[model samples]
Target: MALAIAVGLLLASGTAAADRVPLPALVKAHRGEACVEPLPVIRRDHMKFLMHQRDDTVHEGIRGARHSLVGCIDCHAAKDDAGRWVRIDAPGQFCASCHEYVSVTIDCFGCHAALPTVAFRKTAE
Candidate 1:
């Protein structure tokens, strides 16, 4: 009976550990030391910031490079092993990896481009 109980405990603990799998490492930014804000701040409030920025751009015709989605794609999008530019929604890329880990579905790419705009790309170059 004692041996059976010990085996059950071990199995339960193993299951718990499996349920607590660590999050994948975040992909690196293409420029600078970190994101626009501190890591924790961005992790928590990025959607809020993005929403506000989007409203301003779409309704008010105000555009700011620092907070625009184009800025994000320009800095976060990276080249894959084959030298092709990876989209933000690609697995292990900037946006997809974190969104996948958190189980959040982003619909921004449904209408907006996931890659940076041509003007942004040229300016980056």
Candidate 2:
């Protein structure tokens, strides 16, 4: 009877651990290519990289070829059912998905456009 209780408790704990919300599925880039960095690297250090990129652009006027938030928006922006581009904060959108899953507040849209630029939209068209 004690062994049965121990097994039941172990199974319950395992189920609880498995109940964690999984990471959201990221939309493919407009060009259907891989990201600038690997998934694990971006997952761990993307905020650090974005901050550095922001500083360089703001202070030094040197926007690197990659790692800019604008670049990410250009690539990851999604379209609505009506074929109109949607903002990053929209539900199921690229940025919102992961941010919502992790319960993190995103402040980028407060200062920057949440959707891709007109030029980017034209290029995709």
Candidate 3:
């Protein structure tokens, strides 16, 4: 009976890992610089898998957070220092720049938004 239970648990665990979309390697590839490609669109089912991995309840609010409506480049792409949108290097500025135009206060930066190099120094840490 114990052997059967262990087998069941192992199968369940394997099924869970198979559901999530692997995060793009590009996001972390450039030394934690912003991703060059659009962030992969993780589906709702995959998000549910992630919440389950965290042992959290699958609430509607949590699911909403999981749905990917846009890719990172949709928000981050901008004119570069070389006068081209494709070459923009500063990524945090990508989000911040738009928020300013929209007249919205960006609180995410208050805790989370430092260039990757300064992320370790964040007070939230």
State TM-scores per candidate: 0.74, 0.77, 0.25
lDDT of 1 by residue, 43-91 (tens): 7898998999998999999986467887888778877787667788988
Arrange candidates by lDDT, descending: 2, 1, 3
Model 2 Cα shift for residue 42 (angstroms): 0.6
For every candidate, C-alpha RMSD to the true structure in Å: 3.7, 3.6, 17.2
Clashing residue pairs in all predictions, respectively, total 0, 0, 1
Candidate 1 C-alpha error for residue 66, in Å: 2.4
Task: Give stretches of model 3 more than 4 Å off.
Answer: 1-92, 117-125
- Candidate rank order under TM-score: 2, 1, 3
| Cα error of candidate 3 at position 96, Å | 1.1
Among all windows of ten consecutive residues in candidate 3, which has the lowest summed lDDT? 63-72
lDDT of 3 by residue, 15-125 (tens): 998896343222222233444333443322433444453343234334222222222333334443564334213433554443444454634334432333223344522
* Model 1's TM-score against the true structure: 0.74
**Stretches of model 2 off by over 4 angstroms after superposition:** 1-21, 119-124
